[model samples]
Structures are given as structure tokens and as C-alpha cells.
Target: MYTLLIADDERAIREGISRSVSWSDIGIGRVLLAANGKEAYDIIMKERPDIVLTDIIMPVYTGIELVEKVKDTMPQVQFIILSGYNDFAYAQKAIQNEVKQYLLKPCDAESIRKSVQKAVSRIRDIEKKEQFIASMKENVEKLFPQAKEQFFRDLVHGSPNTQNIEAYKELFNVHDGPYRMLLFRIDDNDYVKLLTLKSLVERNFGEENVTFCIIINTAVVLLTTLTGFHELSGLVEKTQKQCYANFNIEATVAVSSEGCISNAAQMYKEIRDIIRFEFYLGEGRIITKDDISVFRNDYSLDTGIQTEELSAAIRTGNIDSVKSITNCVFNAYRMKGYDINRIRACGIELFIIVLKHCEDCEINAWIKNITRINECNTASEIKQFILDFAVKLAERTYQSVISSQNRVIEKVIRYVHENLDDENLSLQHIASDILYLNVDYLGKLFKKETGMRFSQYLLKVRMEKAKELIKASSGDIKVYEIANATGFSNNPSYFTQVFKKYTGCVPKEFRETGKQEEKDSGWLPL
Candidate 1:
């Protein structure tokens, strides 16, 4: 549920709002009340509630001033403007602030609830879009670190990263370095503060050498990185000087060590370590690597079962066997609770291997898949996905290999078709042309690659040719002529008998049937 802040000069209204209609029902679980705009502003600076309700007229600071202040610093805070006066000026001010609803003085509970509900829905939707973009950026970074490098290059140099996917995601990419993390507190992240910080950073230290991502107006996370952990020491000094001179707010910097940012999900723990130790910083101050070094966690999260071996097995077309290996590996890891980072690394290797194989084999693939897998921080889950994916891959490979092996027979058949007129085109000739072994071995391979013996196949070949030749020739050719024309010489009667044995009919009869079949099949004869 979203948190809410109620600000009004009238104590009765403030107290009444705190008790009335259960703000929790309207998606507000936590509600705070302030008697005037000044008190409301202070509360906002501290709590940073999602929604604020204020009257236009309040003590010390008008609700209009409060709204403007909050809008300038905390643009995300939804507001409902309340006014007793029905003047056009007050309504104009409300409109300027983008107030969701303007409630009259003593507005009923339903009116307030409805307005807040709508604001909740809008904020939630905005949050979801933001999350989606964040996820996209994360995936793109892991898959395309070069793109990430360019993003940081542009960001540090005060240029847009070409306004592409990573740029539009508003994500900062880190280079190959050991980075530290820090979570800091801010007054508010209104558009003014966000743009101001961005502008100041761009103007002050526009260093071509260093890369950074500065997303202001965010109270929770300020993700930044140093080229090296040692650079983090310098970063602390630089961040301190800037925070003191510019925003004057207390901020904490969590420094992560140098490693692959592809494992950034693990680094979140490092940042949270800083958050948990935030009280150690006392007031707003820069906490260097030395200060936070003692608290760093060497603990690794659980990565699901790894299946890279299975993926490799699949790529090589070792199907059912590799799948069994995957299951056994999963059981072992799940039982032992292996280090997740290591498992995740293996899963990444599988993806890389698959990508490399696809490239080497010159196969077409959907490129985005590699990006998605690379972005995943959880190793075991990736491994299982790879294994599952490999199962199908292995099956396909097996079928393909079978098909290729099976084509040898077809090749032998084709060789015969091309060289049938050569009397020397026997089993030895056919096997040699198709690159088979010795004649004896070629005969065995021929039967294996096809489903017929060499001698039988040759008979089938010659008989079919004889029938076609007889049907094609219009003149009544002599029997001996037909025999000599079709790989037999000087003995037409012998050729006819061989043809009769194969087709259960003499060559002439076979030709007569073929001619009739062709005529029935709509052949336009010459």
C-alpha cells in the first residue's frame, strides 16, 4: 500500500483526515498529518510519501507554495488540492500544479477516496513502466557491454548515449572494473533537483576519461560506479565535496570491488550492506571504502541448478544422455547448495558457447535470446533453462544427423543415374564416385545408407532406364540396338530376359504399359 501525507491549517480537518474512512482502503497503509504547509514540507523532506493532500491556504507556507516546492523537488508525489474559496484564481493555481482533483472545503470522504484511488492507479502504472525499462536495460547491458560502455561514455561527457535502448532506459553502464555501491538519502527528487544535479555534474567535471550514470530525483538509489575500487577512494572525496557544496544533504557511498558488473544482481547486496550500516555514517557524510570495508559480505546467494553441461551436450547432439546428466547435476547442486555465482557463470558459458556455435556453423538465430540469458544473475535457474532448451536442441541434432547419414544411399543412387551409360559403372565405380570404401565395404555401406543391396539396386536402375528408353523411342528399334544402347552390348534377347526378371514383363511389354500410363497422365508426345 502507498503512504499518504495530509496537510491542512485547520487542526480539525487534519485530525479528521487521519481517522476518517480508513486511508488504507484507498491503497494508503501509512498516513501522516501536518497542521500547516511548513510542517507538511518538513514531513515530506523526511518521509517522502507517495501522495500529499493540502489546502490552498495554510500558515507559514501556502499549500500552493508547498505544492510548487514538492513538484520542483519530488515530481512523483501525487497531490489533491483543497480550497474553501470558489475563486477562479485558486482553481488556476490548482491546475498549474497538475493536481489530480480539487476538493472543496469539507468535501465528503467518498470524493477524497476516489481521487486518491485514481492517483494510486496512475502511480502504480508509472512504477511498472519504470520497472520494465529497468529490466530491459539490465538485459541489454549484460548482452551488449560495448553498448553499455558507450552509454557511460556519453553520460560522463554530458552527451546522450544516442538515445537508443540503453539510453532511453535511463540506465548507467559500468566498464570492466571493480566497483563499489552506495545508497544515500535525499530531500526530494523533483524535476528541478534532478535536472540541476544533472546539469551541475555535466558542467563541473565533464571528464572524458571517467564514465558515470547520474539519475537524480530518486530518493532510494543513486547508482554510480568507479573505474576501480581505488578510484572509489577518490570518488568518496569528490562526492563529499560536491554534496557539501551543491545539495548540502548527507549522502552515503557504498563502494563495490572490481569484478564483472554482469553479476550486478550480486552487487545489490553490497549496496544493501551500506544501507544497513547507514547509521554508522551519523549525519550526511561521505563514507569511504576504508569505513565500509569491514562490513562487506563474502556470502553468495543461491543460484539454481546449473545445466551448462547439458547445453553443451545438446549442442553436440547428445540428446537423452545429456538430459540425464542435467538431472543428476541438478540433484547434486540442490542437495549441496553450491555457490550461485559460479553456477550462473556456467549458465552464461552455455549461452556463449551456443552463440559461438551458431556463428561458427553460420546458422540463423534470434539474437535477443543471448541478451536475455546474459542479463540473468541467478545461475542455477539459467542452467536449468539451458538444460531444458538443450533437450529439444539435442533431439533436433539427432534427427538431422540421422537424415544426413541416411542420404548416402540417395547419393549412390544419384551417382548411378549420372554414370549409368558407362559399362564400368559397377558397384566399385559407384562407391568410388560417392567416396565410399572398398567394393566389398561399399556394398555394406550402400545397404546401410539405403535399404537395398548393391546388385538389386543396380538391376532396378537398369530396368527403369530400359523402360524409359523404349517408351521414348518412336521407331521400332531392333532388340540388339536397345541392349547396346542401355549398358548391354550385342545381345538384345539377353537384355530382354534381365528386364523381364526385374519387372515380371519383357522390355516391349514394359514399354507398352509405360506409354499407356504416360498417355493417361496427359503426356503430350512428340
Candidate 2:
């Protein structure tokens, strides 16, 4: 809605115009009245009405004077001059002040309304242009970040859109520079913290000198016109300390040497290469070109020999040996300054070698999963990937060998062999309390594999052990001693009965004669 102001020395004329104008039809919601030019100027200044109608000659200030005062300050405000005299000078002054509407005194109500309708139309047009400009600005703000990231990416990749670096310099407001690039490898998943880290850097260095972009997981900061390396380092130190203390996140920054904006690609590459050293050097510290240059060495690894040794360790099921060999391989890669691709290739080769040695279908399935290897972007992740594969393969390989030899049956047999002297040793005890398996299922499986029920196997094993003890004693060991040695500590009479039933003679006869009728080992009575 628009507002209008009417000023006339004659009160009746002012009232008549204000009351008679159908202001709502003209889109004027509020109509104000002023008796003279001074009052009109005061009301205009306070209310900022869209249109002002004033008599040409008045007290305190003339209509021409009021228009002159407001024309420059509020050019949007439209003015209409009313006069009693048909004078050329007044009209000329009004024209000079850019007042387009001039209404003679005693003008009809319809004429006034028509003028106001035109003013409202002009006001609507201005509002429409302003709204359009505001929308454009909002869209520009939304797209600014994407454009900025792409530009920085181009600079880093040496594919800047324009060879005229000066154009970019002007466009991004990058000042004269002996610029240095810092790549921040932030260990954070929180999106807000990335922005906070950027803000912290900008605060440490002035905002104008810093251009920041996030490329993948790293944040690229371009610092222009730094005072010195030490000062930059101090600012970086502050930023790191504040970031951890405030956000509980660590950021490792890689700093590049001094260079110009034109050399930004090289500077960026220098930091980009060094930033990967964080996996070896650890996080939350700054890595400079000088620091990374020391890591390159003449150390070399024999990939084929290392692969063989690693596979052998997995086959032997020695996890410690596997881990030691794996660590040595990664350390060699680091010392030799292998790139990420070479490291990943080494990992894949090691994985494939181990998988080839594993006969277990499950291990084969696990070793064939190359997604984890491809997902590794750093030396640490790659090392961990291979180490995890090594450990799993070793465990699975060991389990496979045991399973092929009938692990459950072997475990039961070993237990029986070791504890034949214990009266409490039984398959039910072993299954229910020791190995946590159901007794019935264990019995069925054991008999299926060993071709004898658990009780029959137990009796045969005890009888065999008793005969060995009797023979080894050369008839000097007593009957009770023989029984106690084979899980019958108190019942020597029952031991004698079973001994005679199995060997067709008593323990004493077996010890002295070393011979028996050997009727199916006489072992199936139980």
C-alpha cells in the first residue's frame, strides 16, 4: 500500500482533497495532510509518503523549495505542484526539480485520483525490479560455494579456466601474493565442524588472504601474502589447538613452500603429496615439504619374497608372524615412498596370494572381497586392510586344517587320552560343561565319525590303557594300582571283571603272560 500527503495554506482545499480522493481505489491506504510547505516537509520526512501534493507558494518554505530539499535525498518520492498563478518561472523551477505533475488550483477530485493511480503504477514497477534483484542475489549466494570449489579444484589440477591468472586474481579478490597452500586433512564426520575449522583458519589469518575449499576429505586453504613461514606456523598452531579443544576433532595440516598464485597448482600438489604422510606420521600435526622429503629413502622390498613369506605365515596359522611380516611390508612401502596406487597393488597381491593358499570356501569368499582394498585412501587404511586379511586368513586356515582332521572327534579323543586317569572324564561332561555342545548331538556325531558309541569307545580306550600299564609294569604293579591308573580309582573288583572280560584273563594274567584270547578285543560287552 502507498501513502499520499496533501499540503495547502487553505485548510478547506487540503481537507477536500484528502477526504474526496478514493484512496483505496488508487492503492493509497493512508492519506496525510499538511497546512503548509514546512509541515508538509516534516510529514514527508517522518512518514516517507510515496506522493506529495503541495501549493507552489506557501509560508516557511515554497513548494519549489520543498521539492528541491527532498528531490536528491528521496528521488523515489513523486511530487505534484499546485499553484494559483499561471506563471512560466514557477513551472520552469518545478521542471528543474524533476516534478512531472503540475495541477492547477481548484482541480476536480477525479483529476487528483487519476494522478495518484499513475503514481501507484510507478511504485509497483519499482518494487517489482527490487524483488527481482533480491532473488538474483539469493541465487548467487546459493551457487557461490560450488563455483568456488570448482575453481580451487581447477587450480590444484592445473586446469584453471583462464590462462590469464590476473583475471582469476581479480575475480576471487586474491591479492598480491607469495602464496602458501595448506591442506587440512580433517578427521571429522560432522559437516559443521569442517566449517568451524575453516572459520578458525580465516580468523587466524585475515579473511581476505584466505580462500578455502573442500575437495573430497581435505580442506584446501590458500593463504596469500604471508609475512613469514614462522608466523604462518604460529597461526596454524593456534588453529589446531583451538579446533581440538573446542570441537574434539583433530586436523593434520600440510604446509607448502612460498609461491605465487600462478604457481598455485605446484604448491597445492606439494601439500597434497605430503598430506598422505599423516597415515604414517600420525594426525594433529603439521607436515611441511621438508618433513616429507626425509621419508623418501633407498629402502626396497622384494614383493615376491614378501608375498611368499606372508602366505606361509597364514598357512602355518601364526597370526603374530603374519602381523610382523605385514608391518614390515608397509614400513618398506613408506620408506620407499610408494604412491597410493603401488601400495594398493601390493595389498591386492598379498590378499590374492593368501586366498590361493586357503582351501576353505568361507576364507576364499572373504579374501575375494576387494572392496575394502579399493576403499583405502591412505597408507594407514591400506596397511590395516592387508593386516586384517592376514589375520583372518591365518585363523581360517588353521581352522580349515583342524576341521579336515575332524576337529570335534580329535578334541574328544585328545581329552580322553590325556584324562584317562580321571574317574570324572566322560563324553557327557565334556560336551555339556567343557565344549558347550548338546550331549545327544555330540554322541551321535562322535559315533558317526568313530564307528562306535561313546560308551563303547570309552571302555575300549580304558582297557587298552590298562593293558599298556600292566605290560609296562612287568607284573610288579598291583591290580588296584592298574585299575586306578585307568579311571577306576576305588572299584578294583569291577576293573578285574572288565579286564578278564576284555582280555580273557585278569590284569595279573595279562601282566604275566602278555597274551590274551583276543576275541574281537573282547570289548563289546558294554
Candidate whose lDDT is highest:
2
The weakest ten consecutive residues by lDDT in model 2 span: 293-302
TM agreement with the true structure for every prediction: 0.33, 0.51
* lDDT over C-alpha atoms for residue 56 of model 2: 91
lDDT of each residue in 393-452, candidate 2, tens digit only: 788877776585488888899989898988888988999887888999889889888999
lDDT of 1 by residue, 1-526 (tens): 9988989888888788778767777788899989988999999999999988888899899988998888988999998888898888888987888877788877887888888888899899999999999999898768775665455334333454344534334454334444444444443445566555444444433454334444522523333444454555565556556765777765555554444444344554555445434543555554544565553333222222344565567666887667677667546656776566545544444444444334323333533454555566665567667666566667777787677656766777787888766666688766666565577876887777767787777766776677667777884866677676666775667787776665566766765665434332211112
Overall local distance difference test of candidate 1: 0.63
Q: What clash pairs does model 2 have? A: none
Please report, in order, the local distance difference test score of every candidate based on alpha carbons.
0.63, 0.79
